[model samples]
Target: MSQNGLRFTLDVDGLTPAATAVARFTLYQNLSTPFLLTVDIASDRSGLTAVSFLEKNATLTLWQGNTPLRYLHGIITGMETGENNHWQMNYSLTISPPLWRCGLRQNFRIFQQQDIRAISTTLLTENGVTDWVPSFYEAHPPREFCVQYGETDLAFLTRLWAEEGIFFFDWFHPTGPDQKLVLCDDVAGVSTLGSLPFNPNTREVSTECISELHYRAQVRPSSVENQDYTFKTPGWPGYFSHHATNLNGQRTQYEIFDYPGRFKDEQHGQDFARYLAEGFRHDAETAACASNSPKLWPGKRFTLTGHPSLTLNREWQVTGSVLKGEQPQAQHGHRGEGTTLSNRLDVIPADRTWRSSPLP
Candidate 1:
């Protein structure tokens, strides 16, 4: 529905973004780092101000009327040339989340009997994060752990939750006013787009809503079983090694890379093993689609009705989205309302809903 409903700004670089007639944008959330947004600009050079010199860490915000779709507090991660198609020069820019910028700060610390929740909160706070909450999922039975010397914020956070089968994701401030670094447990954000189970017995299904979808199933290799993984604290011999059974019925032994953090004991090793197995047991299903649904969003659940190959009525969660569009025709020297809305989405199988619902 973005035929005439998209506005954007990059105040960080003092950019006066007049209507560039030919353009496209891609907005991302939840699943990836730098929860990026891509801007594809195509126009005559005379009407275009050079945005290439925009500082690397400038903020970018996208708006639909007064409502903001993305508030990326990170930086301008990338800027490049796209194509000089049909006498038009195409250029692109990318914006990332704060997490990506966190890498510039590195630390070596120790935590003794600390709650993972509290640990994360303190780190987030020191990192300038405010306003946040969590769902009810315990990553491990043990409450404490320690990170080794010289670890980046992103690496530490990702590793800590990954061992517990939790994918740490950032959430946006829904109303577009409050600025906070929200870390979600497993889902996308504070939205109801696909936050529930696909109950086939009830609920009306929307048909032909998706214009394009690329779906795939993936399996982990049996070679992972060729090694054993371990985690240990000081004065301990390390927890039991995790074993993986190959398809031929023989257990393959492999090594889990050294963990920078210290685990309490063998019990924690068992938990880690379980996480590894769970990763192996599940066959990965991924979806990337293009749709015009402005309401379609990440971390929300919805159903599909008219696709031939895709499973009909199955619960799908948006892992991420790229809200993009451009003016169909070139407004060469002057600016006008030529921007439209086209969204690109990444989705997966969803199990449940979020704690705080989003505006429908």
Candidate 2:
């Protein structure tokens, strides 16, 4: 008869109080990517008249408690209308961070004499995200590379950060009501991380069947086809070349990236070369599982039990997660019964060197 914990609040830029039609909204949270809120309004559309007031930089917020958790503010991108019947009107709005818009724009021009951190910080600031912060595992010095012309910002970020073993994500502040940007790195004993003090023992699993777990791994041992290789900097002529070695077998594919700048000397080349060699230390792994109990986050480790094979079970670190919850049809505008937070997480083997340090 009541929807106690399934309530949410939506605050638009100009709106005095955040808005939410209790039984009409569903929230979706994914790793690193922004959270999504889908609001369906039936019949009268007077409540959402503010949709016309939304502008490009307008902010849209989704929250549960006075304090935000696993949820943050999203920017208004679009809206649509649907007709369930002549008298019933259906309206929907899409909200997410400005990243979705800015990420799509092509790089205006090539950058010069800039480091990776510099570029990343600039991009973050320019997109209206002034509070960009990196965890300690991200201590590596700014890397130098020549970016090509006409590339999208998101593409550049994915390519550059991947090589450096870093990722981009957003999380709400523990103390404040704002979403903070995290430039994370996958380094063991170097980045900030904390243990889950709440459930010290193995958390309950949502899916009991052993078939619920999925795993895939690709590894290539050191071999001729997978050996190291070198590439000369485009404009530098014979002065410098970046070399990268594959710790696995011969590579079936290869790519040569040109950052926006040039290496000042051979030492720079050597450092980049070492980066190339160590970049692929971990095998490409894909695994996922569903859980209705323990909530998961990206870059954190968890354990699994009851796998038929020993090799298939152990401590696994989460790489991504999708948190979902649903309730029965509305009773006086409230969802009931099914709102306990259903979640699915993608995980990988916890390689020692890839674990993050204690969290701040």
TM-score of each: 0.64, 0.65
| Model number with the top TM-score | 2
Model 1: residue 25 alpha-carbon error in angstroms: 3.3
Q: Single out the weakest 10-residue window by summed lDDT for candidate 1.
A: 351-360
> lDDT (0-100) at residue 239 of candidate 1?
41
What's the lDDT for candidate 1?
0.54
Model 2, position 234, has a per-residue lDDT of 49
Q: In angstroms, how far off is 135's CA in candidate 2?
A: 2.6
lDDT of 2 by residue, 333-354 (tens): 4345644444577766665323
> Where does the lowest 10-residue lDDT sum fall in candidate 2?
221-230
lDDT of 1 by residue, 78-192 (tens): 6676555556666676766556655667889877677567777777677655555554344445455476468777667666656555544555565553444444545444355
